[model samples]
Target: MTRFGFRYRARRRVLAAGVLAAAVLAAAGCGGASGSASSSDGTVVLRVPDPGNSGVLARGKKDGSLAKALSAVNTKVAWTGSTGPFAPAAQQINAGQLDFSQGSITSAIAALGQKPGFKLFAQIAPDKAGEGILVRKDSPISTVRDLIGRKVAVNKGGTAEYLLLKALEKEGVKPDQVKRVYLNPAETAPVFNSGQVDAWAVWAAYSVPEISKGKARFLVNGDQVGSQNYSIWAVRTRFAEEHPKVVQAFYEYLRERGLQQIKDPAAFINVFTEAGPQAFNGAARELTISNLRQGAAAAPIGAAQLADFDGVARFFADLKVTPAKVDVKPHVLSLAGSGA
Candidate 1:
């Protein structure tokens, strides 16, 4: 099969099976409680996965800002921890297991590509600064080109997969030329540290802790591979269609509170400390904040973001990451000027 053809087929098979599994779960009543709120009822249960290592979510949880802001609209959020990523969350939401959850633009794209039933609610902060490829501290690999023929651990069908594909292409390394291991973050890190893999393309929230322990060295940041993208808040399209006002209010709270956090780096970092120990030290935190500010200054959901999404979709298409050439624009939700 051609490179794209092979990857696309693989993705389709896996995602198709995943959708079937979700369908069974839905029929079996194995999902979360249905989160339905009327304008008259005063609670909005915002179901989020356990913010395990998500400093942004953890920080918001710590200061009570995330809850307080939502409560302003007479909505209270309830977080639900699950092992599933965006696709399964979409399934759960469809199965009436969730109201809303945190997801990246790529996650939403992949999930929607599989089922097309979720609606992007709002563009959260562009966490572009968070994803990267890291090598062990003592590893001889110094550059992306050096990784050729080496074993690399990546979460296949994830943001890291796309990031690594772009990095490898930029370095003129063919996909099959390297040894790629498919692993989730939990599995990838321990094995990466134990020398089972030469490197890892991991999300920043996970990568930071490894770097802090001197377990790895960053080879390339995701921002260098693509335009600054977002971690979007999305819900089932059915839910959104029935409750436009609730959806609007939720978006408004996230945009307003997120912007406030972005404006004050020091305070943001302080709040993040509650998430965990320092992975990005003060210097790193400052750099991250600067990048977030740049993303915030751009239109919340601008043409630039759409362009980036297109570029990413094309990259995945060329790499044969999905079964079909997908259009990412329609899935994105732009809550412009509703930062109340």
Candidate 2:
């Protein structure tokens, strides 16, 4: 062939090879993309009750802390806040409508015993001596001893119930010795204010409102019960298995941000107010900072924390809340050593 003809033929062959290679890479890319999309099909949804009470989670979402952290792992988070108490949130998790929920250790333990569909995933916040037993401002009941034979309202299957039981035990009182009235904080608050119930076992956030209204006085705090407890985050076992990475990322996000908040009280208080309504702004912010400091000083999740859980489980078992004692090791997920 002539020189020009030979050059043209060489160019045609090179162009053809390039097109073939492009086709192969395109096919491989398509297959890999399809596999990845299929592998990550669903978004993880975390249900938290009352944005007011969920400081780290709520502030993380509002300030993009959760979103930024989860984005690094290519996971999506859908945070839904509950309007009522934790029972409704627990029900949602039981019904499989939620992947996980934030609740008190007592509530999660009770749910695990009653509903076998869920499992405790992690301990979120250690009890900070915050919750209390409250009585009407001018009532004759000055001490827990005065509550004997009195109608004391407590939300059964809730943190309040556990606190009340422990408090009574510490005071050498039997559970059945007092008239226990089961009422949620929302329902019991009004009645307690109207002198309907002699006392109310409630968290500090709820108790603050009643106290501010001159309707209630703090009788005892959680620290007086002789047990150090914590709040927990739990998920359905199936859901956790399916999304282990997502679960790890969620836990890490919370821990990092939670610890950061624990370090800076003023910053946390500011972010907290921005997270939700200012319903309990002043008191809530101050109390949360105080509680965070306490949790920070406590032992980080390790064998000691596990032992603490064992004590908690025994407490519940003794109260007949669970059929028998449970080994908390199998249920607790420790992100600290997981290297996630």
Candidate 3:
């Protein structure tokens, strides 16, 4: 389909989906509620992922602005003490144990393939340099073709794996020519640095520190590989339907803070550094700020986001990573004024 045709189709399907969501919400009310708890006075306790380790969320929570803002909408924040590897977070959202979290498009696609428990309500454009294939500075393998016959570490069904597939395809290399070691982000660094894996396909959280420390360099990034792995926020379908106002408020909070983060990247980066053990100090910290400066802020979902979602869904289906291509329009919703 032409670009305009695809976008128009997306808008129509999304509108239909929005109506369906409202109906689901009404049905949920009759089913005795499926999301976070509400008190006798009717204040919603929004159960969300812990923000202590994340840059934007952590900063917002620490300064009390996030809480104060939510109170105005008759919602209370409940920190669920969880961070991400978003697949598990997706599962939590499905089970109603969590309400919201941010993850890559690949994770959302994979989760939706299993169950339609959430809707992608917001998106951040791909951070091209933030995710890629990482190799030790002295590794003999320097190009995508060099990856043939080599072992690479990647999080199965995640951005790293997606990027690897794209990178290999771009270089005209077949997937089976390389041995892919499926490992979570935490396990990748140890195996890659110890020479157990020839290279690690990873995102910024893991790749940046190594790159800044001079231990590794990018063999290829999302930009070179033609990646569509945008960063996305998922809210439980029930939660969003039951509390649309709260969801919109949260999105607004993120959008505003994200804009501020872009303007003064260091302020947010400093909060990120102080929040956890994985300190991106000195050059690493500076590199992160630079990435943030170039990064796209979060915004309500739109046609561009829908197009990206469909692209990822089709890519995964073709690779057999997913059983079938997902019709992303039904599984996503655009809030008022969010259309592209």
Candidate 4:
């Protein structure tokens, strides 16, 4: 919060930039948003390529929601395409690999701690609906406290991990008291459903399918614990500075488009997965649609949201999830000059 601290963080980013430049050069043409490109027609092209699992932003092209918004400001787009989560995509952005990405606050804090030189552009969907820890519907682990000494599956270093930490704290339990089985999505359902892990702390995506089947029941959810995954949009800092107008267009687009998606997630899932129906199967997509309606709330980037960032940062620090405290305030941008 002090001037010196700000300078120190800035210096760290400068150093990280040098390292990122090397990574960019080494991994050229690998795929996804390619370093702020332009089209041959003398039009400026902004690359996003990936919209992560949700594809909420990427789907904007279908309705011309993003394209029209950007074109209104004289910008064209080049799709580098989407692959994985935000951390890697964010790395590509910092390394000049991509120009933008969206992710949960926990991952963004980790990215910030790494000094990726990306700025938080907007808060997209802050929802208290899906964060949950589940056990078999007939299981005896009926409450958060009941998980004491029992194994819970979580994707370590991701949102689910943070949920477990906060859930335990709210229930007056220490983290180590429960067994944590760390697994990615591919391995989670089998391990969890077979009773290899007594409970699974997860939100949306992989968790939704199982819960929708009526095989599992929630022991606790974000609404119950007063926590959430504040999903956000982030831009590579250099790109935003060089093309402020372009960034502003995306800001306006995300705000307007995100509201539309949250209001009708079923429609969003339809558009987002039309090309790749396998992206989310019938069960998962339906569950997501239900949760999005019940959970998603849209808000402008502001003090209250920033405070949530601080609280999550402290949670990361306490769990030693992040190496040290990351001052997230400096990187958040205001939409003043952006076309409202």
Task: Give TM-scores for every candidate, taking all chains together and pairing residue i with residue i.
Answer: 0.76, 0.76, 0.88, 0.82
Score each candidate by Cα lDDT.
0.59, 0.58, 0.73, 0.65
Best by TM-score: 3
Residue 6 CA displacement from its true place in model 2, Å: 77
Instruction: Judging by lDDT against the true structure, name the best candidate.
Output: 3
Candidate 3: where is the Cα deviation over 4 Å?
A: 1-33, 272-276
Q: How many angstroms is residue 179 displaced in model 1 relative to the true structure, after the best TM-score fit?
A: 1.8
Clashes of each: 3, 0, 0, 1
| Model 3: per-residue Cα lDDT at residue 224 | 91
Over the stretch 135-190, how does candidate 2's per-residue lDDT look in tens digits? 88888887777888899888876677777788889989988888889985656767
Weakest 10 consecutive residues, lDDT, candidate 4? 1-10
After TM-score superposition, the amount by which residue 173's alpha carbon in candidate 1 deviates from its true location, in angstroms, is: 1.6
- Deviation from native of the Cα of residue 259 in model 1, angstroms: 2.1
Give the TM-score (vs. native) of candidate 3. Answer: 0.88
Supply the global lDDT for candidate 2: 0.58
Which clashing pairs does model 1 show? 4-320, 44-76, 130-204
Which residue pairs of candidate 2 clash? none
Cα displacement (Å) at residue 78, model 3: 0.9
The residue ranges of model 2 lying beyond 4 angstroms of the native Cα positions read 1-54, 81-84, 269-278, 282-288, 297-301, 336-340
For residues 245-288, write the lDDT of model 3, one tens digit per residue.
Answer: 88889888888888887787766655544533544567877887
